[model samples]
Target: MKKKLSPIIAVSLFLAVISLLFPPSSMAGEERIQQELRDPNPTLNPLQKALGKKGYDRAMASGKYRYVGNTKCRLCHREFFVGRKKDPHVYTYERLVAIGYETNKRCLGCHTTGFGVPTGYESFEKTPKLVGVQCEGCHGPGSEHVRLHRDDASPFGMGIPRPRPQKPKGGKKEIKGGFLAGADNPRIIKRMCLSCHTKRWGRSFKRTPHAFQAAYDLYKTPLPGDEGDQ
Candidate 1:
């Protein structure tokens, strides 16, 4: 005996079948949003912005425009400095020397820290500390930053953003500190790398990951295999 179902019941059954075939948003909901957020080369977050004019002004105003070498940075960032020693960049000069190209100007430009800056690497004898690619290589000359960090009047350090002071009804008012300018912005990092990773200079490096996400990961990861020049 065949009994016909009501129109409403038939419709409900059809919808249930369809729902099984294609689940509701809740079934694959928040994970999609999370996946989007987890994209490796994500655009800069809202907190980041280019330094532009402000950075230019500060660079010009900073009287301490000389390269202080990686040793100076080690005082504050010992862990990072240790990690850098494991990085290939730290041995750039050594690699050049090993290959008998130590004095080659073309190689020296990228092999040494602050190659063109004042008080920068001149010769192995003159600036032994600046022999390899160093912290100031990307951060620019760090002499001024180091001085300000030590100075009691305006002590600041690496990667600090500008702080806006609020007027409170307290005994002493607060003074705002400036941000790290382009440090957080990924684009600045890309440009800095590209400046040296040009076609002529970067043969093997071309195969390496250039994205900020990859670079960030590499910064933290310990070097693999042999420490010798390859």
Candidate 2:
């Protein structure tokens, strides 16, 4: 009494039924996009918590100090190690290569610590192993002070972080970086953020706020198969 359906017609009808039964995935994807659009990179607020330009200028001057290599800085900063072969900052050099750069002294000057070194030792093999900006890279070398701190003797340089005034009751300071807050010396952390950003950038920032943000501490980042701490 009824006409038989073609095989193609049966498959199309089956797909239509399945589409009606199952919900479309576009709605959820759109919700995720809206959420990201609302507050992408919430942690960034230059006007609220920037280290400022003056802070970075003084920070870069430390590179011209006695020039203790990165290995020396690692002595105090071993806790933040990423366990990689090259220096954490050396990784930036690889990025430059992608855009056609050589490991020349001019390049390494900013890429590595002792790049534009005045001592006539600018080559990587010849320079200190601590290329790129480091804790001491901006905070000045600690060789004179590390022992002093341990011995409770006279302080070494002016780079030590002075004590902050006691916070008033119910008022909290939203500090940056766990290490920056945890450091016995905040100057080391501040200068670390300043070395690269202390360029001719202040004039442009007057129009809009863009604080310096540092992301070099690899240990703090999440690893494979590990759920990150939120």
Candidate 3:
């Protein structure tokens, strides 16, 4: 069998492969250039508007955010459940119950959100056992991230609950407190730490130092056959 080929076809294929191999914008021409880049936080994105410093505090004080209980989170995150029973955070919940805390009161504060708030519970019995620090508790609301998963697939880890594998956004960049050698978007990772770390009201992330870095440094989740990278 003989296959017909043209010189133009061969040259195009070679260029396509070369582009994929060296995806740096330096040689790809102005097609990849952006004179006025769109900010990561577009106006449409609610996280930027709601959590900003200007007036985010006022809305939080009035109980504007949703109260998705821990039970909702434990529906799928049974793995994290193993540690919660023993973690001190659960004990804090028990303490709150012993002291006679109000039932209608919002204990969700301790269970999720609020920066500087230690792992504790205002009530043990009142709050669901599976709810404390579930995936969404720390990783922002699941509404958008979940929906995005349908089309884009933003899994928590390598198709698993806990014990995440390495997902370095930046390839090799010096991020905030350390050098994240594999973080693709080091800056975004830094912003994520504070969804629970030191959150201020609706403020999601005030200062994401390593927003852009190598993918390796952000998360060190080991893929099944990636012993060499470690």
Candidate 4:
């Protein structure tokens, strides 16, 4: 003759047992980014300070930029904003978390937007909005561009200004700033995609109807909400 446990007591005991098997850090809902910042691994020195002020010191030192998140970009590029919401890249972090690699420093580099860049994803706690491959991930940080546009509305002025080339000292060709938007170029765009979609990642995309294509090309394809010739 033993006394039966109450419903509440039974549930509490079950939860306690589960907690012992899986610590709070292993909990699916936990924001592991914060914990990783707290416990910096010596071998992974760069990541230990990922969320620290000094981590982004170099980026900020330039005083030209910071990651303003996709939402900020949405104010201007509404169509692209809508399109990106449906893109698989938007859910990169979610996919990582689903596979329990959300805390893996190596995986986070590609999954997150502006991982090590200034004003990039610090902790989900601090910059949850910046999570996943975002507009800044490809277009580069928008702070400088945004600042320029907010001050003026000229086409030439709104973009990152092509720096004046230095004069040739010894008849050598001057080096120019690299192009910003390479999404339009088939060759350059493939490199951008391969940054994350390497053989190790097991992403084997063919040119079939359902196969992968650059986002710019995919944007041209007709979709449900799009108008004719879109």
Candidate 5:
């Protein structure tokens, strides 16, 4: 008589076969992230670390905004999206891939939009639309912003007027329509940029005092058809 496989071993073998056939991309991505989290080295980014996991989780959960990726942003900001193709930020994730750190959680925070957060980038296979440092990376999550604008643009739209900008409370800057206005919040923008552009990363923020401002200027440069809008 042939020896019977143990229940645990049989279940494992069955799942392995199923995975081979179905190839759960999202599950694989989650597993990859979990694996990185289990590693001895720290995986959370500077901002995430500052918040602490629980604090960060709470902020993301309470925000009620989701990352809609660059594709959604392109619907309205076509010029900016097209213009960004020439910018180096568009290829940030490819840079990591070239260096064989594509799945490195430590680097993903800067390399990809919204990594390690809710509704954020997972693996390229799972969240290909969010592969690079897109608009949401700097502007914060755009789900609410996109939804509001899209509803306003609808032909059968309700005639409800957009909400007036509310005064920020508690000295905390308020994001309008679920988006952080980077131009209006220079300090926040600078902090976001420097979170990744640290001395340890060989960024010239310290060596060149004006580097951040210069980059910010470049970031805000209007595309050919965007001058009047700006």
Candidate 6:
């Protein structure tokens, strides 16, 4: 008569047989997916591709300016702020949450404003204000700009002063505020937009060369009370 196998031992043997039938590579791949899900600082290849290696290095080089959230931006740019609230970028993080990828670092880089950078979005609890893409997401950090604008004497000073057009010692004209002005750095801004809106995200740049510009135009469309204003 054959000896009776204990339930625990039988179960263990069954699992061992299953592992033998399936290669470790398949199991490893599943493990890698799970590990990525837990990772908070996964590689941001899209961002690197958008900015290029040098640009990516420069953008991540310093943590000088801190993100002050969209509310602080609203203090001065009420119209732009309100307009952005209706934009899809504002709810990108929430979209990730709905799909159960909120914690996935791969999705966070595009969904959230800034990730894996100093003073950037970390977690919902840690940085609730930075959860969504806001003014700083495209304009870069605004701490210095906010400070300079507050010190300006012009009543209509909207944080951006008239460009002096003076070339510094290096021959490169300096932007008034420490922010990335769309008029001054159109290329950089374009790259930033394309970084997230790539083919992978269903944004067809190849099929429609002007798709980005069209979307940008919509972004610039003035709100009800924002006519004739920046």
Count of clashes in candidate 4: 0
lDDT of each residue in 84-150, candidate 3, tens digit only: 5543434433443554532323334433332222222234454353334433333333332232233
Candidate 3 has an lDDT of 0.36
Off by over 4 Å in 1: 1-62, 151-182, 203-213, 220-230
The residue-level lDDT of candidate 3 at 133 comes to 44
| Candidate 2 per-residue lDDT over residues 2-96, each given as its tens digit | 98998999999999998765435323434533543364343221211234446424433434224455554454444334343434444655554
Q: Tens-digit lDDT track for model 1 on 125-151?
A: 888988877776655566655554554
Instruction: Single out the weakest 10-residue window by summed lDDT for candidate 3.
Output: 173-182
TM-score of each: 0.53, 0.38, 0.31, 0.53, 0.65, 0.65
After superposition on all CA atoms, what RMSD does each candidate show versus the true structure?
16.8, 13.8, 21.2, 12.6, 16.9, 12.6
Candidate with the larger lDDT of 2 and 5? 5
Off by over 4 Å in 2: 1-65, 82-90, 97-100, 117-121, 147-195, 198-230
The digit string of per-residue lDDT tens for model 6 on 134-192 reads: 77776666775666556443433245655433333553321345554333566666777
lDDT of 4 at 198: 42
Residue ranges of candidate 4 with Cα displaced over 4 Å: 1-61, 151-190, 202-204, 207-216, 219-229
RMSD after Cα superposition, model 5: 16.9
Ranking by lDDT: 5, 6, 4, 1, 2, 3
Among these predicted structures, which one has the highest lDDT? 5
Q: How many residue pairs clash in each candidate?
A: 3, 4, 38, 0, 0, 0
Decoy 1 TM-score against native = 0.53
Task: Give lDDT tens digits, candidate 5, residues 86-144.
Answer: 67778989988985889977779888988877788999889999888878877767886
lDDT of 4 by residue, 162-189 (tens): 4343333462221111112223334433
Count of backbone collisions in candidate 5 = 0
